[model samples]
Target: MLYHLAKNLIMILFYPLFRIKVTGKHHIPKEGPVIICTNHTSNLDPPVVGITASRTIYFMAKEELFEGKFFGRLLRKVHAFPVKRGLADRNALRSGLKFLKDGETLGLFPEGTRSKDGKPGQALPGVGFFALRSQAEVVPCVIISDYKLFRRTKVVYGKPMDVESFRKNKASAKEMSEGIMEEIRNLYEIHKN
Candidate 1:
């Protein structure tokens, strides 16, 4: 409820300022557990994706954002969970899996951090790990533009990637992560032109 209300308010406020354009929304799966992988370029990436997506997205936010008690509670209310960066956080992983098992959409920024130059960075292995373990389809999203105010920001959602193939082939975690990142990069390129 709060998430939708916040997203609606954001859309009303930011849409005019940013002129955000979301394309390929139909690519998002209508049902079932799914993972959304997007290239993060700015702090605004989360809101942009969350608001543009048709489904509720539970983001794996950095633990630092949850440091304060009040703010942390607010974040949780909006469906954002804390994730410790730089290492494998089993708790975060479990939370993500639980969300998927419950047939909810999970949003992930595979790079783990925002890109400084607005380009897709190397993805963390966690995304691939979750995709394989949960057997959830991965949707690649590309956000175009530098997110400057008054400029058009375009978000393109690509078709879902099958993680089951990688699992069947017994692909390594690194391989799965690279494959998913490649798809995200391709999606970015496809929309960049």
Candidate 2:
């Protein structure tokens, strides 16, 4: 629909300009309720990750981006929803869970914000809460880039991590978040070297 059309247009513009390289695309579940956990480096991360994957992704964008009427309308059309940063926004969480419950893909940047140094930061507990609540698989995605115009950028998808183990152990939200961040960091290291 509109999402794919916009994605196709952006890919046509971004692919040649940035020389984006996506790896491990097969790791994405062909169909299922899954969480796409990725490291945020720049504003381009969402679109890049969205286009690289075979399935459509509903991403949680910061609330500030939705302040403008026209831009916010555009974002909504492309499957982007507003999320309040720095606090637990229940509405946003509910929306994300609803998507998963409906067997749709939900994209999240566990770090909560883009890294200034291009490294993965500590994950917020919301990701863990969502995974545990929905009992969905979490796929670790690593986006490596310097955000330079017309430069090379790489997006790596890691194997999906199941929430079963954490649930079996009765792990807390913080513990699950830490474990998820550890997995993402490991994926980053593996691809870095």
The digit string of per-residue lDDT tens for model 1 on 100-151 reads 9999999998888889888898987888888888857789998887877899
Name model 1 segments beyond 4 Å from true: none
lDDT of residue 124 for candidate 1: 79
Q: Can you give the lDDT of residue 143 in candidate 1?
A: 89
Q: What is the C-alpha lDDT of each candidate?
A: 0.89, 0.89
TM-score of each: 0.97, 0.96
lDDT of 1 at 98: 98
Candidate 1 residue pairs in backbone clash:
none
